[model samples]
Every structure is written in structure tokens, then in C-alpha cells.
Target: MPFVVPRSPELPAATWGSYGMTTLAVVPLIWRRRAPVAVLAAIVLIGGVYKVALDGPGQPLPYAGLIAFYTVALQCAPRVRVAVGLATVAAVALSVGWKTGTARELLFTLFVSAAAYALGRLQYTRQAYTEAVEARAAELERANRIEAEQAAARERARIAREMHDILSHAVSIMIVQAEAGPVAVRRAPERAEAAFEAIAETGRDAMAQLRAMLGVLRTAEASPRSPQPGVAELRELLERVRASGPRVSYERTGSVRELPAALEATVHRVVQEALTNVVKHAGASAVDVRLEYGAESLTVTVTDDGRGPGGSSSGGHGLIGIRERAAAHGGTAQTGPGPDGRGYAVRVVLVTSPQEVGT
Candidate 1:
């Protein structure tokens, strides 16, 4: 570009030294982002030397020096930014020689230097804003992912609890019925038939409850809805227990008020688990199932005049499940000898508020 066009026709031709200085000034710019201050100093030194040795500033401006000024504005400290920009403007002014040029040309060269610095400042600000926005978005995405995982974990725990409740009660009844069915068949065929019928009924009930609970995992378009039985299903639960275990007498005390669906279901499960324990471990002749509705709470007590609990040694989770269910509904459960010191008793008291029931 030795014969390249000039800014004005009257300007002198570019010398070999000028070309070398321009190359030295610009070549280090490749590393400007990594070493901005150093790159700027190198360009300034080259431009100064070229100005001193040459006749005057060439027709074209010192583009390399201007770029270095802008880079300094973007990457250096505030004091360094001012010094570097001024140095660039002064270099331009000195090379062109103010005594030789008109005020218009001098002003135009300074303006160009100042504009580059301003543009660099704009680039730095824009890049900084974009990076901040991206970081915020990433943080929000991380929080949402954590919340989603927590919800999924809670749902899995609920499903496991429901399944445990169902299997413990249903399997206990079936086991007792199976053990009694053969003995009764030899003594009274009709009694054996009734036992088998009870076993089948219990299986059907368990299947329905399981389908209802597990349906949440499937799409609505595929699985049919199965409504879970709550308070009203107590009678059915008692009926299922009759053939396999001692007679269960159910009594309701206090003013009966409608409970939340979750409360009702929890109570039903507590009773079911308690009764199953009696049949599996107590060997008691009879059990009392009492439901008391209070102003602010619903209480249920299941007591059996049996030998004692023998299922804990057999890996039974009946009592643990009962306590877990009670706590899930903001309730407390206690297990010990009945008040009369005659048999085992499971007493559960649950709060009546909607929030307590977690509806």
C-alpha cells in the first residue's frame, strides 16, 4: 500500500519507517484483550517515534493508536483510561503539528481519537450487561430445577407410604384367612367358603386402592380414575377384618363433622393398620375401634385385649406406618397399654384445619 490513497492530496508520501511503525503499532493488538495496557504503550511509543523522525503526520490518521486508546478505555482503570486517550489525542496532534494545520483539521483528528474511546466504553458496558443477564437466567434455571426435584421426591414418598398402608392391611387379612380357611373347611364348609369370599373381597379392595394411588404416575388419557374411600369406608374395612380376626366393635363419639379428604383417609388408614396388627399379633378375642370428633381435632383409638404385639419381630411396619400417617396430617400418635392396663392401645389425635390436613 505504498501508493495508497491519502486523506488529502497535499500530504507527503508515507515513508518505510512510517510503514514499520504502523505495523509494530498494530501487530501487538492481536493480544490487546490479554494485555491491553502493554499493547497500548507499545503503539503509543511507535507512533511517537514515527512522528519525530518523519516530515509530518501522514495523510491517513494513526488507526493503530486510536484502536489502542479504545481498548484501554474498555480494559484499563479510570485513571489509565484518561491518560491513554489523552496520549493518543496528543500523539495525533503532535504528528500533524498544530502550527502547520488549520484549527479544523486538528479538531477533527482529536475528535476521531475521542470517538474511539467512547465506542470502546460502549462495547465494554454492553458486554457487561449481556453477561449479567445470562448469569441471572442461569441462576433461575438452577433454582427451578432444585424445586422440581424436591416436589418429585415428596410425591414419591407419598406413593410409597400409601402402598405400604395398603399392602400391610390387605396382606394381613389374606394371611389370616388363608390359615383359617383350611381348618374351617374340615369343620364347617360354609365357614370356609365365607373366609375365601372375604379374602377375595380384600384383594379387590386393595387392587382398587393401589390403582387409584398409582394412577398419578400415568397419563390421564390412559388410566381410569379410582376414588379413594375415606371415612365412609370404615364399615367395609371392618367387614374385611371380621373373617380373619377377632370381632371389631366400632363406636363414634363427639359431634360428627365432615373432615377433610386427607384427614378422613389418614384416619381410615390408622384404623386399618391398627386392626391388622391385632389380627397378626394380638390374638385377641375382640378389639374396639373408636372415632371421636372434637371441635378442633379428630381422635381415633384402637385397643385390643390380646396377648401383645408379636409382629414387630416379624418385620412389620404397622405401628411405624400409623405414626407416619398421623404426623403427615399434623397429628400425634401414641402406642402403649390401654388406660385400664388390660390390652394394647393406639391413640391418634389429628388437627382439623385444612392446612393441617394438607388438602
Candidate 2:
């Protein structure tokens, strides 16, 4: 607050003028944030005038100059700060004459002015650093939350696919067996007994698979233990369909080799879904299925002369499901007319090697 070590006596004749000058310099500080540089400039100019016009030589001291220096230090950039601080020091030093013995006051002014600038600079730097750290923490928290949501979505999709595959295939066969039970019972009890047994088997299989999936959701520690359906189980799937309806024939073009579990499952699902559509939508009496294995990939095609409008095939989620499975494995599925142009056909091609879809 005191720039001079020993205070200078106030000029009695100009006491009111001195009070006016101090008020003009310090009061503008309330609006410093809006016009910081302007306020500092006004105060500095007024301090110089107060020194030369009112106080006279050998009596110069910073009544409000110290406050101005600190405000400028915090608000201005580095270069402007240096200019304002140095100019302030020089203003105080040059105001006093060399003949006067006020060397102590000059030295005190230099130390106080430099100290004010340094303190203000320190406050600015600390505040800036704190804000940067808080902003970085907030960004990291947002990224982690987004990643958690994505993981949850993927899990839900997996469960949906599992339920669809298990229930749709098993339920389709069971429904056919159930409907024929009454008719077969009237003709021959022997055939009706076999159909009843088949219905029970399919229902039991569906229940077991459902339990496995429910276990996974019950707890992370209790995961799905049963082996999932794959290409190896295609025979069972085809046999089950044969017992139901829509005669399906299967043929292999190349040697069958071991493949990824997910890839095998994708193949099985595509064919199973295709055949299910044949049983439900297609009025065709027979369906043809083929699996072609190559060095780089595998291809499967299912065709049937189903009696339906052309739009039903693509308008449903069935085609989308087939395409998603193929594309997930870096492959594709296409649907159009059959080889004979009399029915709907679905052909799927899958690359042997796994490729990240969106990485």
C-alpha cells in the first residue's frame, strides 16, 4: 500500500485535489474486467499528473499506482505486462530529482512494483493450470461412459440373436409335428407316437438352450456352458426340417474343414433361417440347398418355389438378418429369383479369415 518507506507529507493546500485524483484512479478498478487496459491506462496517466502537478519534485509516491500495476499484470498478455510494469517503475524513478535525498523511496518503489507484478502473474498461471486439468478429467469421464454404453448394446444384440435362432427353428418343427399329431393318430397309432416323440424332443432342446442363455445373464460367473450350434450340427438341423415339411436336399461341393465357431454358427443360422422361411412362406413342395467350400471362402445357397408376392421377401427382417450375419464376417448375402426364375433364392458368401467390421 505504501510505495515510499517514509511517508511524504500531504500538500495541505491541494488536499481535496489529491483526494479527487486517488478516487478517479482506484474507483475505475470496479469495471476493470470489461475494459482492463483502458482502466490501467487512465490510472497510470492520472498518477503521473498527480506527481508532477500537485505533489511536486522529491515528493512522488504511488497512492494508487501499485493497484494499477497489479490489475494490468493479471489481465494483460506477457509483453504488455512487461511494458506496463517497467513503465510504472520508470515513472516513479524519474519523478524525483537527483539533488533530493530520497534514494530510499526510489528503491522502495522499485521493489514494491516488481513484487506486485510477480504475484499477479503467479495467480494467473495457477488458475489457468487448474482449469486445464479439470477439463481433461471431464473428457476422460465422457469417453468411458460412451464405451460402457456400446458394450451394453452389443450384449443385448447377442442375446436377441440367440433367442431368435433357438426359438424360431425349434418352434417351427414342433408346430408342424403338433398339427399332424391328430391326423396321424386316426390313420395309424404308430406314426402318431413317433410325431409326439419328435415334438417332445424339440421342446426339450429349446428349453435347454434357453436355460444356457439365461445363465449367462444371471451372472458373469455363470456363463453359457452348452456348445452353440455350428456347421457340424447342420445335419441335425436338416433332419429336423425334413421331419416337418418342405422337402430340403443338401449337397457339398468341397472338403469340410475346421472353422471358427462364430463363422460356423453364422453358416448354420443363415441356412436354418432360409429353410424356416420356406416352411412358413413358401408353398413350394421342395427346396434345394448347396454348400460350396473354396480355399478362401464358403458359399451357401437355398432356393424354393415359394408362392408369395415378390415384395414379401425383402420387406421382412429375414433378409436383413441374413445380410447382417454375412457382412459381420466380411462377407455378403444376396436375394433374387431362383435358378429357374420360379421361386425366391438366397445366396451367402463368407470370407474364411475374420475382418474387423468398423475398426
Candidate 3:
């Protein structure tokens, strides 16, 4: 058997019908956010004409037209907005005759539409401005984070270079003294005793420089010592390491100038760390250290003659520590066999003026 479809119940007439239709027109306003132009156009075409057709003394459809007009004015571009405003005024003028329409009614409708439009416009402008501000803030934060990462990398490299320079020189001196200590004692006990004394003094100096350089790695609060070290201290570091065993040499290529406190610390740390690694890892050997201070940046290199300790193949705590120090200052560290194919070499480069550190 075929089933019959039910029809929608008929709407009642009177002020109620007009009121219901007016309410139906207002429904489109909810879609104003998604499709403002379309909703406004539909309300104007349907609601506007309905009010004119109803032409009764008290029709509610006019209120729907006012709502549509307000939406158009607020959401549409200036040109379209002006056109919508004119159209709304014309609709009202036509529906309510010039002679019969009271001045009070006309003013009230205009005032309501204008008020609604102003409110909608204020809301839209505030939301748009807020989003733009949030986006810009996020972008700045991202840039700052990237810069911080780069600085940290550089600082680690500097520390590694310093360690290599200090250790390589110290170990070379110690080895030479150790070998000569026995020979000199057999031949001349006095000379041997002097050599041993020199060795002890050099060890003390290396320890001091190592502490100072390492202190920079710790947080400011953690490190109570003042922040500053430069090429001047490099000489003392070289002397101590030289006494350890290896015959070491140092040369400054460019005009050495005072550097920023942080940078000075960075340079000292790099040389210190590099030398430490050389003494610990490289066997008995000779080492050479070079420092070049250019207008833009500084470069340090440490080379030793001990048999290749093999590339630092796996990253250990020391390597990680070195890397962290370099990154903090926007520098880099690289370790490998020396160019002469005998021992390990470490090189570090850093900018003189680094970005400010984060709190």
C-alpha cells in the first residue's frame, strides 16, 4: 500500500503571521558571520518586499528589514555598505508614504539600524585587531628562540677550543718533563729537581685556568667569580701546558683588542677546553695554537703531534658539554685528526658581539 506524505501546518494570520514572518527573516542574521553578503541580500529581497506587501498599520516585517540593513552596513565593504544603506532608506520611504509616515517612526528606524551597524562594526574591528596582534607576538617569540639556539652553539665551540689548547699544551709539557726527568736525574740531579718543580708549577696554573674557564659554563649565580678572560690569560695557559711536556708555540695574527666580557669568557673557555681534551686524549706530543682576531669575529685552532686518538666518533659527556657551551654563545666546535696526519685538532670560531642572554 502507498503511504501519504503530510504537509506543513498552515500559519495563522493577523499581527501574529506578520510577527512570525518577521521572526523567520531574522533567522538569516545568524548566518551573517559565515555568509554576510548572501544573508543580507536574502533578507532585503524577501523581508523588505514582505513589509511593503503587508502594508498594515502594525506590521512587524519592517523590523526584519532594519536588521538586514544593519548587517549589510557593518559587514560589507564601504562601497557595498553605502549602496545597502541607500536601498534600505528607499524601501522604507516607498513602503511608508512621505505624508502618512510620521517623523518619529522614520527617525527611530534609522537610529536603530545605525546603532546595530555601529555595534557590529566595533565587534568585528576588535576581533580582527586582536588576531593580528597575537600572530605578530608569536612570530617574534619564534625568532628569539632561533637566535638563542644559534648563540648557544657558538659558545660551546669556543669552550671546546679553549679546552683543547690548554690540555694539548699541558700534556705535551708533562710528557717531555716525565721523559727528561729520569735522564736528567741520572746525569744531573739538580737540573732534574728544577724540571720537576717546573712541572708542578705548570700543573697548578693549568688547574687554575681550567677552573676559571669551567666557571663560565656554570650559571652566573652558580659561578661566583667575575666574568672576563682574553688573550692575555692565553699566554699563562700556554706556559703551564708547555711545562707539562710538549714544546708549544702561539701567534696572534690580527690586532688583539679587548673583547666583551661574555665573548672574552667564551674565547678563554674554547681554548681551555680544547687544550684539556688534547692533554687527556692525545699522547706525548708537541702542539701549536693560533688565535686570529678579525674585525667581525675570532678564530682559534689547536693542533698536536700525538698519534691520532681517532675522531671523537661517539658523543660523550665531554663532547655534549662542549657543544652546549658553544651553542649558548652562537659558535661551533669541530674535532678531527690534525692536518699533519699525526694528532687531533680542534677549531672554534665566534662573533665578538653576541646577542643578549635570556634571563
Best by TM-score: 1
Best by lDDT: 1
Per-candidate TM-score against the hidden true structure: 0.82, 0.75, 0.58
Residue-level lDDT of model 3, residues 1-359, one tens digit each, is 00133323463334555555666677887887677767777776666555556633233445555555656655678998877777767766654564358877777766777787787778678878998999999999999999999888766765665676555556655666777899899998987897798778767766877888776776566445554566678887777666555678898888688776766766666666666665656663688889888776677888887766563323244555555556656777777778866677777776665443331
Clashes of 2: 0
- Estimate, for each residue in 145-205, the C-alpha lDDT of model 2 and write its tens digit: 9998998887787678778777877887788889889999999789789888888988998
Give the better candidate number (1 or 2) by lDDT. Answer: 1
lDDT of 1 by residue, 1-359 (tens): 54554545576666766666556667988988888878878877766666566644442246776787788888888998877666666766775674466778788878887798889999999999999999999999999999999988877876776788798888989999999999999999999999999999889988988876766677657454455568899998888887786888999999997786777888888888888778777777888999998887889999888764343223266677778888877889988776577678889999896665555
Question: Which portions of model 1 miss their true places by more than 4 Å?
Answer: 1-11, 55-62, 77-117, 212-216, 220-225, 309-315, 340-342, 355-359
Cα lDDT computed for each candidate against the true fold: 0.79, 0.76, 0.67
Error of 1 at 243 (Å): 2.5
Ranking by lDDT: 1, 2, 3
Model 3 lowest lDDT segment of ten: 1-10
Clashing pairs in 2: none
Global fold similarity of model 2 (TM-score): 0.75
- On the 0 to 100 scale, the lDDT of residue 195 in model 2 is 87
